[model samples]
Target: MTESLATTVRVEMVRGRARFIELRAGTFLSPRPLNVEGPFARLALVGRYATLLAGDDLRVEIDVGSGVRLELVEPSGTVAYDAQGGSASWSASVRVGVGAQLIWRAAPFVITAGADIRRHTRIELADGARALLSETIVLGRAYEDGGGPLRATMQVYSNTMPLLVEDLDLRNTAHRDLPGIIGRNRTLASVLLVGARPAKACGEHETLLAGAGALARALAPHAHEAQAAVDASWERWSELVEGRAV
Candidate 1:
């Protein structure tokens, strides 16, 4: 049977405190907000299909009201199972209101052998809004030689101006043999910060694969390493923002 999941989360300022105005999950998706001491609200995912199967379609939407701060986390990583000639897709759309802040530290998504998947992310930030997002993708399981095809895209905008746009397609054989494009690496990771002035650091848009601590570090790197990098990045970003605000 084909499975589908859709989740929508909305947060707004209520009397100077950020509150979840709307939180809904459909079908096989579950949203669990964490109770932690922080300036931002944190959320986690809990459900069966968190490890997606063939013919699964998952959609996630998030909205942050003006002046609210929100953080999203995926406790466990997602793995795409072998489809046996079937396919799956996952998409996320996020909108941040003026002066709102958002940080999404996503877990690694692995595509096992024989799986076929399509993933896309679209984000729109209102004037004065700020956001930091991270994503990691692994081609196959540890010690696995091959996996199915995957096409991923990301589009981010600040108000009406585009901030970042990317498209990546990887398939068996081509993904492994192509030099400068994953090469022998099976993992790819990226971090994006929007609503900030373009920096000369690495240009306005940057995509790095197999760098320090990256999956390229070893022949078959554990997914936890990638997740740790993402989490650390987010923590550093939050500290930077806090320091700036002070």
Candidate 2:
């Protein structure tokens, strides 16, 4: 896809309130304004056209200025259809200014049989900035055996220091199905908090990273069930993000 095809959303603090400074529509996704609450401005991601087809490339860019709070939501889940021997990709890059906050309640992403996908996210947080993010990946639709290959990667940094970095390759069924790995699970859900420390861990899947962040991950037979596993951690961590003193 051309560089102009990338969607961009930018928000900044204006007169003690968060305001959208830029909104650019892309070939795949468009940013729509929602209501605002206090210092937070809400935005919904709307699909401009059908997506996840073979050879499709989707990109989203987000920027939040200092002292601004932004919340992003999706109307519905995303599904990747059969690629017919081809592949598709989705990537997002985010930057949060000093003392800013970002909360993204992303919908589940489904991979259907014969689909191949590559997903990635990179977040850059300034000092005292915080972010709460949730992601759910469904292997297949109802009553399906399994979905196609998927390679997922995530990187988060605070200033110039790395907070978290991970890469997962679910493309190989044999390796992915191993006991320590996914193992019979069709859904994987995760909640990640960065740039601040929570009081305590809430669940068995929750882990405090070396830096100032926490991650809660779950694998289950269904998408809804998988999300339930990290609900508590999400709540606590989001509260910390919302009430950040910075």
Candidate 3:
């Protein structure tokens, strides 16, 4: 069966202020509003229970109405435990209306040894809409080799036109050890900014996407080391997405 626990969060502009139109808690995530002001809202995704167990299916949905801005934060990261013979899944779908914006700085997702999990993200953006998203993936915890096998995928669309499609497979250590692949790195961090392009490249890790955005990614032995470059890109790209930078 599919996941029965689907958390949803929706925001819209009302009376010249951004307001929560819908906030539903799922089995895993609870959406709680932290602050709201003119055209902007801040929310925290609080975990209600331990997650990423065998046969666990977790899903999240988000919507931002036209001209509104929503920022989502997580209190902690997630770890996928060994599934034995079963597998787990985590998926999210996002929609940004015309001129709207979404900023999500997701926490790390760790895959422990013997864990098999799949993570997917889909984003649809209307004209003039923008989004800034960050992600960190850890193969295994400290003093461990890595997880069994994990697949991460992402797809982004500008209305009906596709903007980005990516897939990362770490099912085999030999393939993952390829030079161009992750090599010996245990952590991977990425930052994506859509609907606007950065004025300059952050460094060798930055790449301007085929669409109207850019992506910054890095690999390191630890999450903190990989996050530095991605965070630097976030600083510049987030400002442009929010119209704070030129």
The candidate that achieves the highest TM-score relative to the unseen native structure: 3
- The list of candidate 2 runs beyond 4 A from truth reads 1-4, 244-246
Query: Candidates' lDDT values, in order?
Result: 0.70, 0.89, 0.90
RMSD of each: 4.9, 1.7, 1.2
* Per-residue lDDT of model 2, residues 1-246, tens digit only: 333388899998888888899999988999999976667899999987777888889999999999988999999888899999999999999999999999998999999978999999999999889999999999988978778999999999999788998998889866767778888899999999998887677658999899899999999999889999999888788788988432
Residue 234 miss distance in model 2 (angstroms): 1.0
| Stretches of model 3 off by over 4 angstroms after superposition | none
Candidate 3 residue lDDT tens string, 171-217: 77558878888888999999999988876776799999877889999
What's the C-alpha lDDT at position 198 in model 3? 79
- Where does candidate 1 stray beyond 4 Å? 1-5, 36-39, 198-235, 243-246
What is candidate 2's local distance difference test score? 0.89
Candidate 1, residues 127-156: lDDT per residue as tens digits?
Answer: 788787777788888868656898888877
The CA lDDT at 79 in model 3 is 89
Worst 10 residues of 3 by lDDT: 1-10
Q: Rank the candidates by lDDT, best first.
A: 3, 2, 1
By lDDT, the best candidate is 3
